[model samples]
Every structure is written in structure tokens, then in C-alpha cells.
Target chain A: SAVISQKPSRDICQRGTSLTIQCQVDSQVTMMFWYRQQPGQSLTLIATANQGSEATYESGFVIDKFPISRPNLTFSTLTVSNMSPEDSSIYLCSGSGRTEAFFGQGTRLTVV
Target chain B: AQSVAQPEDQVNVAEGNPLTVKCTYSVSGNPYLFWYVQYPNRGLQFLLKYITGDNLVKGSYGFEAEFNKSQTSFHLKKPSALVSDSALYFCAVRYPGSARQLTFGSGTQLTVLP
Candidate 1:
């Protein structure tokens, strides 16, 4: 399993502010993804971060709202734009190898 | 679309007793199943995975899961429950062809009482 590091383990943002969370994996992985999870709730897929191309968003997610970027195999970023109190949740990033996907510590976001 | 289900929202067991968290999945192809545990305010930690071969797969923190193809289920188990084992457990599946993105279950909250 690769070691994943997420910057700014947590943050508190104003309702109209935008915040970007960064995910870095110690080793190169074939797949990278972003997810949103409310505390004590199941995870919701945000998007598939593709290297050198635009991300593939899930049905409820969009580039204009939750933008994702994967510049390379080991690094990706997810930015929450036009945030609102409803956007408050824990943001996670994961990378996959041959069998399993390993996750980062997660970025806890609180919107006020 | 691939999907996973954890029928029980919560499961409670006495300490030192065996424990099981049920999970069932639906997929178009041979299933690649995984179990993960998340402690409060923490990231998900991989427990075990079943890709092929053996039906019973063992993983971290004294946890194991049995992959029953006939039932389309992968249930996490521990021989003896510990208070520390209590957490949110998620069952996930992935298709190798679909960029291997995971489809996670609703999650089961396990509480091991001492």
C-alpha cells in the first residue's frame, strides 16, 4: 500500500469562500479519486481525477462546483467552489494498486 | 452500475465474543470485494480484500472476511471482539475495467461492548 498524505488536515471556511485540498501519494498509482463524506455517514464519489486531462465527475458533481486535478500519478487536488454550509463535510482522496485502494487521512471542512 | 449493501445499520456484541458485519454486493462481473474500518474522526483503514482463489481472506487488526460467491456477500468477522474494534465498517466493490473506482456500501456501525 502507498502512503497517502493530505494537506491541511482540516479547515474552516466562510460560506462564500473556496478551499482546495491536496492529496499526495508516496508511490505512483493507476487510479485517483475524490470523495465527500459527512461525519458518521457513507461516502459520496466526487470525481475521478485523471492525469493530464479533465476529471470525470459523478452525476451530482460538476467541474464548476468541485473541481479536481491530477497533474501526475501521485498527486491530485480537489477544490470546492462557491461553498455553502451544505458543503461542509470530510473530503477524502484515494489511490489504487493491484487489489486495494488506500485512502488519505482526509480533509475535514467546516463551512460557516 | 455496481452497488454494495450493508443491511444492518448497527451491530452490538459483548467483548470477547465473535462478531460479524454483513455485506452483499451486486456487479456485472466477477466481484473484487474489500472491507474498511473508520474510527471516529479518522480516515478509512483497509481491512481485507478478496479478488480470487481462497474464499476466506485475512487482514489487518485481527480481522477476516469470507467471500461467498453464491451469496454475493463478503462479511467481515473477528474471532473475538474488542472494544477497540468498534467503528464504522464499509463494504466496497470494484470492476477492474472501470478504472477500478470503488462502489461503497452504506456502512455498518459496530459497537463492541466490554
Candidate 2:
């Protein structure tokens, strides 16, 4: 299992501001992913951050809104751009391993 | 596309009683199933997973899950619940050879009372 560390554990941002959440892993990994958990809802995949390449966004999500960057194998960042009150949610980062996956502590964003 | 379903929203049980959290999934090919637990303000912790071989997979904290392919279900169970076991539980699935993304269930909130 890999140890993932995420920054800005919790933050309060203005409606029009943008926040970038960072994820760092203890070990190098092949795949990294981003997910969002809305209030009282299940997790929804935001995108798959490919190392040295553009992240692949899931349906109902777009790159313009959720820009992701994976410069290396052990680190990635997800930026919530032009946030709104609806953007308030828990953002999580995950890394895939040989058998299972591991998750970071998660960033709780509150848009006001 | 792969998806997971956890029917119950919340489950209440006594500390000494057995606890079960139901999960079902749908996948095009063989599925990789997993169970994760989350304490408040914490990351999701991997409990157990069923890749192949065994029908019963045991994991951390004396938790086990039975995979019934015929019924398309993988239910998490523990012989005796503990007060500390009260948390949010999630069931997730992915196609072994597909994308690295996981489809998670709605999550089940377990409350173990002493």
C-alpha cells in the first residue's frame, strides 16, 4: 500500500476563486485519480491523471472546470477553477497499486 | 461501465452482535471487488479485496467478505461488532483490465452501540 498525503485538508474559498489541491505519494505509481464527494452522496470520479500527459475527465466533468496535472509518478494536483457554492465537496486523490488502490486524506472545500 | 450498489443507508447493531453490510455490482467482465472503511475526517482505509481464487476474503480488523458471483453480491461481515467499528463503509468495483477508476457504492453508515 502507498501512503498518500494531500494538502489543504480543509479550506474556505470565495465563490469566484480557484483552489489547487496537491497529492503526494510515498512511492511511485502508474495511475493516479481524482474523485469528488458531494454532501451526503457517493464518490464520483473527476479524472485520471496520467503522468506527463493530460488527465482524462469522466462524463459530466470537463477539463476547463477541473484542471489536473501529474508532472511525475509520485505527485499530482487538481485545481477547481471558477468555483461556485455547488463546488463545495470533498476532493480525494487515489493511486492504483498491484491489487488495490490507496487514497489520500482528502481536501474539504467550502465555497461561500 | 462498472458500478456498485450498497442498498442500505444506515445499519445499527449491538457491539456483540454480528454485522453485515450488503453490496452488489455490475460489470461487463470479471470484476475486482473491494471494501473500504472511513472514519470521520479520515481517508478511506482499505479493508479487503476479492481478485480471484477465494470465495471468502478476510481483511483487517477481523472483517471478512463473501463473494457470490452467481448472485453478484459481495457482503462484508464481522462475527462481532465493536463500538470503534462504527463508521462509513463503501463498496467499490472495477474491471481488472480496464481503466484504473473505481465505481463506488453510495456508502453505508454503520453504528455499533455498546
Q: Once superposed on the true structure, which residue ranges of model 2 sit more than 4 Å away at CA?
A: none
Q: For this target, which candidate reaches the highest DockQ against the unseen true structure?
A: 2
> What local distance difference test score does each model get?
0.91, 0.94
Q: For candidate 2, lDDT tens digit of each residue in B62-87?
A: 99999999999999999999999999
Clashing pairs in 2: none
Write candidate 1's Cα lDDT for B4-111 as tens digits: 999999999999999999999999888899999998878989999999899999999999999998898999999999999999999999976677789999999999
**In model 2, how large is the Cα lDDT of residue A36?**
97
The candidate maximizing lDDT is: 2
Model 2: residue B44 alpha-carbon error in angstroms: 0.7
For candidate 2, lDDT tens digit of each residue in A8-96?
Answer: 89999999999999999877456899999998888899999998999999899999999999998999999999999999999999999
Interface RMSD of 1: 0.7
